[model samples]
Target: MASTTSRHQVQDAQKLYDDRAAHYDDSWHPLFAHHMVQLADLKPGDHVLDLASGTGLVTFAASMAVGQTGSVTGVDISSGMLQQARSRLENHDLENVEFHQHSITDLDTLSVLRGKEFDAIMCASVLVLLQNPGQAIKAWAVYLKAGGKFITDVTHPASQISLITFERVGRGLNRPLPFYRVPFQKPEDLQLLMEQAGLRDNHIVSLSQLEAANAGEGIMAYMTDPAHPRLDKLYTIEDADDVFDKHIDHWAAELLSRPEIKNEARKIFKEEWARLANEEGKIEEMDCVFVGIGTKVG
Candidate 1:
């Protein structure tokens, strides 16, 4: 059973992913998903489960790996994301794949998966979202058969410098922002997590890809909107004018109550963003992903 806090976190995450469903694949997640599938080393006729399977990037790839004999079940809390996955599934010939609207934290309640065991269970880039990731892993391991594979990944703490810097600046201004991502600093951290979850023969590896983005644009987006990663394609700037105004108003009233301090903080924050954006006209960072694979052995 999920605690109240976990339920609320799941709900918030559901909305977050739902809002970003249109633009979720715009980033580097697609390529990472394929890499996660490769790490799984799935075989034909291997029943697989993809947790937090957003947009079916991993689910689709896993379905292909399992061929026609094996089935792949995808579970997500966001219906909007699943809609995209299902839409793509309609046009594809992979009938062995299916998506369900459910939270990974409460997988035990999913009736479709009851009494079922999987040959491999893969959760890609979603551990940071959970408040109690170790517990989730332990629960997920129960669904894996003996000698089955359990694959998941975590981002290096140094990655996503923008969000980290944002939170740091916010704290300096006496306005703490909750980033809600676990700072996994090394591969051993994830390996130990799996081992504590009753998994064995753990293997951990790091992969990095150079990623570049317009820092100024992203900083402005984060400043004006609480939801920094907005679906710009789905909602134009003009269309989101009201949302932007509301967020700004809230920040002024709640985050920075003092007018003088607020003005000074805003100036400082803008300057920091400008400095970051001025770096070669864009921010280039290494997107380091640590992949962890373990075997569910008795």
Candidate 2:
């Protein structure tokens, strides 16, 4: 039983992915490919299912690994994204891969795939976006054959410094930003969810650890970077420069108003701004992703 709010979220997510379909792979592929490839772990002649398979990043990779004898089916809610995926498959002459349009939240919609089991079910970087990730995970596990593997990844909130920084600044200005539509979860929470879903021998892997690092580019550059997959979803303001400038000004003013650490805050602010301005500034933060794997119990 899904909540009304969750239903609305599904609509929103579908729109977002559809809007981003054309450019989704361009930014996301490089960042997420390594983890997806590693977790797919497809052997020759193995069957794989790729849920929310935007642009077939993992789908194509799995197809290659499975070789000619194996098959890969990718399902996504966004028709635009599926269209791109289909084009890729046709262009590559990949006969072993296929695509279907289906919402992850609607398990009933997956009835077309009923009576089918997979050697590996991979849902990369998609669980966090769901309105009911736990429920979805449980549903996905049913498609796994006994002893088959279930794999998914989520962005760890702590490592999302930009969003955290924006929220802090927004709060200081008394204009709190909206919480991310797709909220993150702690590693332990993921483990518990998997266990509840009847997946055994759970394992977790972190792709990158957050650290004090600086990007040599300014906030605008960083936000607009084509390489960062999350940019479009996170930065929705029409004029990036104007919005970022106001945020910095207000944030700086708030910092200066504090008596105890005004001086230190100003220094830190200047350094941060300078770092954003510099294309070579060492941005001291790492994006972290947690990949969880579990085996379906008999």
Best by TM-score: 1
In model 2, which runs have C-alpha deviations exceeding 4 angstroms? 1-7, 162-185, 209-285
Reference-based TM-score of each model: 0.72, 0.68
Error of 1 at 155 (Å): 0.8
Residue pair clashes in candidate 1: none
TM-score, candidate number 1? 0.72
lDDT of 1 by residue, 142-206 (tens): 99999999999876655664454444445566564434343465678888989999999998756
At residue 88, give the lDDT of candidate 2.
Answer: 81
